[model samples]
Target chain A: MFNTRSMSKLLVVASKDQLDGIVRELYRHHVFHIEDFVETEEEGYEGVKIGMPLPQASAVSTELLRIRAIVSAFGVARSDVVPERKESVSALSARIDAELPQIEAEVSDLVDRRNHLESAIRECETKIAELEPFVPVQVDLSLLRGYEQFSVLAGHIPAKVELPVPAEMYFSGDVSGNLLIAIVPNERLNEAEQFLFEAGFQSMPVPGEEGLAKDRIAWYTQEISRLRAEMEEVDEQVNARKEKHQTFLVACDELLTAEAERAEAPLRFATTDTTFVAEGWVPSENVEALTAALRSVTNGTAYIAEQDFDPVNDNVPIEFDNPDFSKPTEMLMDVYSRPQYTELDPTLLIAIVFPIFFGFILGDVGYGLVLLAMSLGLRRIITGGAGEKLLKVLRNASVSSIIFGVLYSEFLGFALPWEPIGINRHLNIGAEAHGHGPDIVLMLVVSAWAGILHITLGRLIHMRNARRMYKPGKHRNKVVFGQAGWILVMWGILFALWSMFELPLMPSFTGLSPIVAGMNIVTLLGAVMLIVGIVAIGQENSLELLELPTVMSHTLSYARLAAVGISSVAIAMVVNYIAIGMMIEPAMQDLSLMGVIFIIAGIIVFLLGHTLNTALGLLGGGLHSIRLHYVEFFTKFYLGRGKKYDPFGMIRKFTED
Target chain B: MAVETMSVEVAEASARGLVAIGAGLAVGMAGLATAIAQYGIGTAAVGATAENKDIFGLVLVLTVIPETIVIFGLVVALLLLF
Candidate 1:
């Protein structure tokens, strides 16, 4: 349960003619993780090079590209269609051969028409904007342009100015600026331009259309509407095509993708003039089945053998073999990294502990129900992927929250009828009538104890990992001793604190007589353990001795479990106090139209306040809980960077054999 | 004699207020320190995440590692207040 699945090195040798059969069998079995071959110039490796892909690879790729283009043109998304049943490969191939070209031609033609209409619509809109500035002038568009002897200047000017030469000018005034048009003789154009430049004139080119500006604008608007109608028609045609062929396109895409992968599989193999060799990793239990499948496919011409390899030296891909209950936690594990084949898998431990931490932080019945409903609702909508996996994790966390909520007797910061069966988080901030206020102290101590236990578990796991990684020797013994020293140090700190302070739930050793000076027997024992632990750790690596304070600090870090929970509870109470005590109660004292409005506003406030708090609770509880594992807990032992096992196969959803 | 008794009462009240202020400062200053530490780390983490999205988890853990200081300060404040 703690280890990844065992893998065996698989080597398959076959004649060149049987390469196709071997590839087919391997892909169907879906157990091989092929390691690509690299050419070498040493020894008997002459003429042994990486094999070329099958001759049909190029054709398959071309067909795959064409299908993809059609699929994209139709705007078909995978989620847009649900496959009713798996399609037969032969039938799909025949359909592709018969109908793909017609579909492609129709889609391309419609797409071209759509593109043409869109660009034309954009041109008309641009023309309309250009003509809009001239509408106030009320001049002919032909008169604004096509002036040879007279230079026409038209644009917005700050104010009217006298031209240096005699010219015909039109002026219009508005809030933005004055629009002006001047027709000056070409002989004196430079003098007129210089005079306009001084008046802060921003010039625009006269549009190249004929007739009145308003008339041309009206024509362009009508043209735009007509083009838009045409565009809509093209879009409707495309949508119809999408509705008709979306399913077939999605299936064809899947089938062609698989075919392309199969055709290109030989590129990973090592081949000579007569034979090819494929090397890969397979799960040990499936080795026999795979060998049998290969034998049947090649008619005894292929040779399959299990090659011995060292787990330490070889690059064995790691596949998690966790039980179904703990499988979803692999998402969390993957966020960090996959565990090495030889390393201990911590998925089961995380699965058990992570949700507990989440529940402890957000222990409230109302919020728990909200989260549960949200995760379950989202899970139904998002079927598969990281999002679905995350929702599954949240489902587990919400269930844990419900359990903790029951124990805490908290329902959205309101006290339940029955007394709290667990730590009374509400009591920390003056919920004394409900319970004793010093429960906060108890909560802190419990969190510290949790930290101690969690860190000790990490140390033990590290020791186990050390034993597996190293042979019994001075170095291995030192590493194991170092981990043990950390455990001892944690216990020593706990014992010392217990002896010094009369903490809740802890037996006080303060009553005992002093063994040395003011130190009691328990205190002396704790001191001795601390010294010995430090010595052992220093012996392993003296630099680690500097990190002695971290043991105390890391233990204190777990106090956030109580601290964060208390803060959430405090916020929830404040929200209730404001919405009910400050607003609704005042409104209730007097009944008027304003009072009714105030009451409604108060209800809105309550709902919004609770919604914000719930979101905050999820963020705080989830991030903090997972952070504890990733930062504080995993830092103790986890050294992950294992290769993921990706077998050579496709799990077809839309197509079948 | 009456004035002396009143002065003693005033002294006790002020002492209590100081302790409260001390607790607040413990948490506040630590939070500020944590913010300062996270500033540099957060910017670099964002840059790294932009380049490669897969390291988001690792960067998140790194970004929050300094938050332990704030938690430590909170523990101290809790010790002082209750």
Candidate 2:
């Protein structure tokens, strides 16, 4: 809760293997790296630089060390000029680490190869089934006597043609009735060709155009099946090799585990800056031994503080803590939520007013209850920071709707179905029963009153800030005769109007006569003091022209409450007219197609219109709420230009995990 | 004062027509503003990347800042359409 402007620096000394351990410790404690050795400080400007920004250092350095260590340990002999000597024991360790992974990898590769061959075996089996139908049946052409006699009459013409069987195969053909015929096996085909020639047919040689794809499928299938069987045998051999490889890998993994553990162990450091700083936190009983240990480490250069055991408790829940920001844009994001460090957080104010304004704009119980239920459901599913912020906003908005629903005396767009406990119901909107619906004029008047209070609160916040930063006496005077003064005058003027107009009340306008008069005097004094402050500010800024118009215009801006209230009700009336008109017709019929459709459409449109109106109202309310904060409230008490705090560790690239 | 009264009437009509044209040009003027703003930001982003390839992410975020104006104008156009 207390702010400290001081910064601390510490230096750590640890074994070379424990470098990562020290870095991790620093990271955990939010201690940012001030400097580091990194290659290529600027893009396209490759060089080994002594230091880089902490954000970049954290991202790039860890991998650089690991890669360098791995390369050195493997004894690749980086260069002769490299200072490190490759000893026998270290070289042996490196070989075991490298070869062992290779062995395991090779085994996995063999297993994958076998699996692929197995898939091929299935494919071959399918091809074999298809080829079975196409296998040729045995036949004899010379057996028939008639066929033999006809062959004598037919002269054999040497008709040459390329065969699909292979280029080496020959074919002879004789034509019967201009038909040319050839067979793939020329020896068996000659007798048939001779018979065809004698039947008075002419023939010519032609290239074979028939498809043999089925035959090829059978051939390839058989070949693949045979190769697959061979691969199965190979797989058995590979598995045996892999078993031996696995045993070797196990030994290497153990050695690597030992190395990793050694690398991970915390280093014993005697450095005064990092080591001795812990002495302050040591219990009183252990003070002597800790000091003795520290003396042995730093040679007594360490300056240590001893204090009584009064533990500072930082037990605040994380949700309540101000969000950690490491970049400039985060400051703007904070403004969107609330300036938590400031006395007044705008988000907290927005949570109160935004929903109320939306409810007034909507003015329907059914829609409000539905929205409230939806908001509550949606809040649980939200995950992102911005999404969560939006949910928080909606959660408050829904609550406002419920509150306004009560005021409207309508539930689920109908009169509350249950009996009233204390307050009497005025009208049942669902039944279309009119019993003097909420007085629009009265709503506007109340809206203005609320506006006055909100504006006053904004101005009060600003005044408080000014008081906190500068002279309290002058600020306190302004708060009374300046901020409070305007609020009083507004109330007084409203009361006087009520009195003059003889507005409705049980006691009547004349009841508070003395109070009204006294308020008028106070209002006058406040008006004077405010004018003086304005003139003084104008003089300071050298913009006296801005003083009068700005003051007058800003004060009158509160009247927008009345304007907006009237507009909201007018919109609702339009919707109501639309909805009710849907239920009626020229014939005044009880049941009609047009009437039903109209009713359905009107109900839908009415809900949509009210919801949209409510959304717009919420936005306006939120912005005006902020406007009041920025111009009136924050101006009073906040010094907004203060630099925000940023403690650094990880620089997460939002694109990455 | 005019020798030709019809000519004077034509001139008045022309002036009114010109005003209507000016109104139509308003959208184009906003578009021009958006274009100029986008170009300035886009070129700066390109130059930044040229200096440092690693700054692509930062450059992309920065480039989108000026695009907001174009988006706002687009919204206005959509509102007009609807």
Candidate 3:
């Protein structure tokens, strides 16, 4: 659990006669992370080219494609609905090849019929819409057309439109104020159409078939309903078939994918006419197990060897090993980079500190309880959906917040009437009470102390790492002295500042004078440490002296923990004061119509205000707490570029392994 | 002449006013500086993290590192105001 799993390189050589058995055995073990073979001119490593998959690979691939098309058509991909039974791959493929074509034909037949019905319905609707506008006019539709000398412009015009028509043109209007027809000499057709177009008129499309508008409307309605009824029956059939085959199809997909992956594995192997070489990494502990499995499966035809280790740059894949409780913090490594196999894994440290910072910022019992409930309620969905890593982190953070919240006696910033078990930050209640500002300063001091411990621990770890990385015989001291000096300076200045500010809490210097004049004696100690630190580091580069101010500011930065908490609580208090104190209390004291409105408004304010604070608390608290670790703590020691381990076998989502 | 006519209580109140202004300036300017720094860092951090998500944790830390300036300002403001 202290570091990444130990890894070693394994070389597997197999004769052509036993290659399949060895490959299958490796798949079962799922240990090897295969490296792609690059053809080299070195002795015994040269090859014609990478070997191709067995002759059966092409046939399996084609069958797999057809199954995919059917599966895509059905579109059922839920991982939860796994098959209750397991069947052999050959049997599954045969069944798929035999049954799928008939099913595909059936489904396509229904689809084609549905498409035809839909188009017919659309055509009928278009016909009905065109003829409806002409229904208000009583004249027979054929009489409106087929004129040689006369032109008929029949359309809908505005209800009260005045068109400038010459004496030669004739206009007809219907009582429904929709149908309009203008008749004029063929020579005047352009003039009349232009006039009608200007007067907001739209021409209706004339239908070719001879039929009454009423009859056509009735016919179209009947046609549409008939198509819809047929469509419903087709949908039912398709759904029934889908429900019956979904599980089987998912199993087929998994089998096909597994087979395809295995068949393609030969692409990474360097092969000659009769033998193959497989080079990959497996954990040192699993090397014996892999060797035994491969030998047994291939009847001693497959041989194995261990390559010599390279300490400086072996490029082994990393796999972290942590206790169950700290596993969620492994997710943080993904957000950051995984530690190199040679270096330490900091998941345990992150698991401990991240939640402490979270709870400190969001300390309120009521909010914590709500968050706890939300995270717990979503446990199942989170485990199945995005992941349980986030849920676990949140669970720890919420638990911490609850502990801190009860200590602070805050239930959404209302300041509970009872005394706190420890200390309540918002304790000002009477005329002689200390105000909010001083209380905030006290919180800042607490944050600063936490920062001091966090930074000191970081420096200790950094110094240790640097020492470990130093060459064995080299006397070069690049780390320990510098970190020690900085730690001394930080602690020293903290005491000095506390004394200068006249704060009640100040760390005492062991067996030394507390203060001389206004300057604390610790300040004198701090100056000495700073100068000595610079001298030790000056040999490498004196420019680091400038970083003293930056480092001091970094320590001050931890006060944000207190600053964030104060703002969060301040908002909650404002909400409670305005919503309850100003509105609800007044409404309760005297009942009236306006009072009832005030009570309603007060309740809304209370709910919305508290909910908003809860959201802000989760977002700010979670991210900032993470930031403290990443920026303030992790920067001290960790450097990451470790490759992750990828096993050979796929997790079977559809069938039993 | 205005200072000579001022009462002791009035003079003390004015001194409190000036201190409050100084505290406000300390925090305000500091906050502005933090915001400016974060604007550039936040954008670059986001862009770099998008290319490789593994840098997300480190990018987040760098993005918020400048926030310390505001806290320092707040400390100064509190000291002055109190």
Q: TM-score winner among the candidates?
A: 1
lDDT measured at residue A385 in model 2 versus the true structure, 0 to 100: 59
Docking class of 3: medium
Cα deviation at A520, candidate 2, in Å, is: 8.4
lDDT of 2 by residue, A544-651 (tens): 334444333344444343334334444555556555544433224666777677667777877877777566555544444334434433444343332233322332
Could you arrange the candidates by DockQ from highest to lowest?
Answer: 1, 3, 2
Ranking of models by TM-score: 1, 3, 2
Q: Ten consecutive residues with minimal summed lDDT in candidate 3 chain A?
A: A429-438
Which regions of candidate 1 deviate over 4 angstroms?
Answer: A42-44, A175-178, A197-200, A427-435, B1-16
Chain A TM per candidate, in order of listing = 0.96, 0.46, 0.83
Q: Mind giving the per-residue lDDT tens digits that candidate 3 earns over A1-657?
A: 767788889999988767777777777688898877887887876554687886567877886787787776666665646467777667776777788788778767866876888888889888888877666555556766787987767677775445465423224454344676666678777887888888888876666545666676787789889888988887788778788888877787788777777777788888999998888989889999999888888878677998987643667788878899888878877777788766677889889988888888898899999999988988866555226788878889999999888877789986667765543467443333454433666677788788888988888877776665566442436456767767766765665565445654445554455566545466676666666766655543567667777567667778878777866887888788889888999799999999999999999999999999999999889877887777877776787777888877676766544
Error of 1 at B77 (Å): 2.5
Q: Give the higher-TM-score candidate: 1 or 2.
A: 1
Candidate 1, A459-505: lDDT as tens digits: 89999999997888999899899988888887887678778889887
Query: What is the C-alpha local distance difference test score of candidate 1?
Result: 0.87
lDDT of each: 0.87, 0.44, 0.76
In Å, residue A588's CA in model 2 sits off its true spot by 11
Question: What is residue A562's positional error in candidate 1, in angstroms?
Answer: 0.7
